[model samples]
Target: MTSSNIPIATPTFGQLLRSPVLLLAFGFGSGLAKKAPGTFGTVAAIPLWYGLQFLSPVAYLAVIAVTFALGCYLCGAASKKLGVHDHGGIVWDEFVGYWLTMFMAPAGWLWALYGFVLFRIFDIAKPQPIGWADRRVHGGLGIMLDDILAGIYAALVLQGTAYLIHML
Candidate 1:
């Protein structure tokens, strides 16, 4: 059945609390916001990115890899349970995307803020392949792919900007 035909309701906080998958998928409750849920979800990822920054690069990448794998499953499962395709409340993808954007970032809150802004820009703009993936893909992987592209785009711009500033 087409996603449009699926009958689904926004999951309640109680349901999110009851289900581990839902909890993570909803970005630790940030996705529950009535307005700008995705933005809230991305904001919720900041603290997590802070802790992750302490890890060695290899370890950090490993963690991201594992989280991405788990997100694929969790996001897909949550979408299925909700009978929705990439529900706005499913923001595990945002967590992963933000983490990816922060990879190798400079050690400062300024860098983190820059990464956040860049990631949000690319995510919201959905330029080229990012938008293509969002329209063409399905399931959990689909939900994650668009954000992944956005993260990559943001990461490139962030790193380039950092490099230019450092060289100045």
Candidate 2:
């Protein structure tokens, strides 16, 4: 049954903590927040993004590839468990989305902050292809696609802003 027809089963925080897929899909418990779970999920990604800084650009890209694949599976699994597709609690998408947005960004906390803002704006806005993917895609891949597009949009804007700043 579709989530709308059936009652959605809300997992307890402890249940979420116990399941690896749920834990990752929930952005390491950031999704457990009573409000703005997506925002918190994105924030939870900061440490990961910071850790990624040590990798070379190529390695970073590789990690993103693996993470995206994993996100799709975990997010889909979580959605299935919750009886919802792309539920708010399935926030692994946001983590990877933010990471993609910050790919090759200027090296600094300020730049990361800027990337975070831009990613959030684009993800929330869902312009063009992102909106299209959100509507058209389904399953695990769908969960990741829209956010990936949003991240790309954010990355473009962030890169342009950084370039302009550099010029100035």
Candidate 3:
């Protein structure tokens, strides 16, 4: 929701396709926080993480893989329609990205914290190719690719953390 007395006009389905505001608004509304939407969006993955962790590591990886692939298409179309790239609310990329970050970490608070920090850092920093992808790509692929990079970064950091602490 925009923070103004002026009401936002609703876009038709056609218009929404040209604008990312609608889809991102819907996705990030899952958090509904006035504070950092990205942090809240990452927290929003907790319940999902609990449910998904029941499966094996391979299953978790598969889920992230499939979700990322599908999100690429969906996010690209939404961004194309909205004419803005990587609007804040389309945190489906964030969701899968965090899940992927957690892939190597063992299930527990330590692993969760590691995932949270690494994903948040990479997501916020948008280092190297992440920034490149965000700027260069258009549509859903653009929206999703940076987070995938974030996930990979987080995964590596988690691996290093595990080694440092001897958790691996």
Best by lDDT: 1
Once fitted onto the true fold, the runs of candidate 2 whose alpha carbons sit more than 4 angstroms away are 1-8
lDDT of 3 by residue, 1-168 (tens): 223443333334443444454545335354234557678778787678878878888888889888888788766654444444555545778888888887757768878977898899999999998999878987777778888899899989887878888853
Q: For model 3, name the residue pairs that clash.
A: 17-81, 18-81, 18-82, 19-81, 19-82, 20-82, 75-140, 76-139, 76-140
Score each candidate by Cα lDDT. 0.91, 0.88, 0.72
Of the two candidates 1 and 3, the one with more favorable lDDT, higher being better, is 1
lDDT of 2 at 36: 81
Stronger candidate by lDDT (1 vs 2): 1
TM values, all candidates: 0.94, 0.93, 0.77
- In model 2, state the lDDT of residue 81: 75
| 155: Cα error in model 3, Å | 1.1
lDDT score, candidate 3: 0.72
Worst 10 residues of 3 by lDDT: 1-10
